[model samples]
Target: MNKWRNLAILTAGVTMLAACTNNPYTGESEAGKSGIYGGIGAVTGAVIGAATSSKKDRGKGALIGAAVGGAAGGGYGYYVDKQEAQLRQRLVGTGVQVQRNGDQLTLIMPGNITFATNSSDISSSFYPTLNSLVTVFKEFDKSGINIVGHTDSTGSLALNQNLSNARAQSVASYLSSNGVAGNRISAYGAGPNQPIASNATEQGRAQNRRVEITLQQMQ
Candidate 1:
């Protein structure tokens, strides 16, 4: 909820290019280049998420926020290439949804896999995706990973907020556990306030309940 407008504006139209290597957070490999959008997005999202989250949740929030921000920034100028196409095929087979806006690569997850109604336990099924992400990160030369958590707008505002935070933390924990470093990853929860679909309907609610993973260059 913090500086979304300003961050989005500053990230618009920015482009970046870099090499891929092992992420400090995950120790897994990554691909794709880094960019201005990714760097700024990471910074803005981390700062804002840290400021708004409870003290207990701030570390996870910063990790997720930075990743998503970096993804958004790197994504703005990304282009699909042979490697990305191959990555897409691999992700699709593993139940990891992939979306592309230009050069940016967005990975979408069903809430069921990333969280359990206010709980932050990472599903076993999610590990393959995480491993794949690490591979992608190592393959590319980017320095950011965007991890964003979302929820359906059904519960009280406070409950949803905590749920979102927990979800983000869960994903961050998984990445860190596997090999990701705290410096390269950022996490955050949008609660129910940043719904991408209508929460009034089950289909829309499902759409709204998700976590987005973006891989791009850091600005």
Candidate 2:
């Protein structure tokens, strides 16, 4: 959708929201504020997500993509647009899931591809993927990275916690060694405390054991 059209929709939503500040149902101030903001947010989000989406799917993904990109109402939208495109192109077939939220980008690397079973040492096979990522980071130096590691609930919490931290550091170290700036990256380990999926099944457990490289646009 054109920016002008999007702006028109946003303006209408905000105006309507402002005009109905009092909730009719509960007689409370700012009635249905959440729904109003959600509507406007969805409009603005299209600006970021629509570009990367396929022409046919643009309409469906724009609201989500823009919301995820946290699009500011300016040229920063374009900045995120370019970065998302570059990531999609560079990380193709790498078994990494790239997700965008507003101005943030996250690269989800599953344990099966990122590390050996219960090990934090850098896997030699993963080097090329990291290299590809480093290349992009160099090209897009205005982004700060966060490497977060997570583990399934198979081992003791203490051990899993340590392993998670080790995995994060290991990835960060590898990226640093390959020319990505240390100052641009922060590392954290969540261990089993932050599971994206249930640990009751192997599939869920596998999904939980992962590393996430998140990028935030620098100010």
Candidate 3:
């Protein structure tokens, strides 16, 4: 009877938490997403707590787990949210696109703005933009940075792959030099294999030739 009552209470708590998906006052979707993490954590923690605790203390343990897990999950969401806001503010008019998908943030740097034609060297004009990124990255030091390079399908596979790798390395080196932790960064080259746009037209090819930097929670 006690076990059943505890389960019922947990279920009702999770349901109420899920109902907060949309913030009534701010109307921000992010609040709702954070709530979802809290809900999931609460459920998992409750299960573990009930399983581990003595039968007599099962209810208390479940409740404690639910509170701790919910706070941890929701705290992660809030951390990412604050970082995204700072990124958007810092990257304004910088030709870099700040994108958010859940707790991850990606910055798409176009080839024309980031590098020279068919060259691995970064364009001089893009330095200021990178400096701004350095500031934000240092502030949000808990995230891992992934730098990926891409190219159009106009070149031989080997050449494109090599060039992409070189570009990624250059970006990684720059970030490392600017005080972002080296261990937290990884660079990869997708070359023409991961073309985001078609290679059939000049515009498409141009779009495909770019670098993407993705930041994700370290843990």
* C-alpha TM-score for every candidate: 0.60, 0.67, 0.76
Off by over 4 Å in 3: 1-33, 40-69
Cα lDDT of model 1 by residue, 40-158, tens digit: 66777776776677877775666677667777755635434444665775676665687765466788888866556557787776777778876666566454777888889888988
Off by over 4 Å in 1: 1-83, 141-143
By TM-score rank, best first, the candidates go: 3, 2, 1
Query: Candidate 3: global Cα-lDDT?
Result: 0.85
**Across residues 19-81, which tens digit of lDDT does each residue of candidate 3 receive?**
365533357643445677777777777777777899888888788777777766676666877
Which pairs of residues collide in candidate 2? Answer: 45-66, 68-101, 68-102, 69-101, 69-102, 69-103, 70-102
Off by over 4 Å in 2: 1-73
- Across 1-219, the per-residue lDDT of candidate 2 in tens digits comes to 475476456545544543343433346764232344444454556555666677776655665654543323234444654777788887889899988776688999999999999899877888889999989898888899999999999979999999999999999999999899899999989999989999999999999999999988765
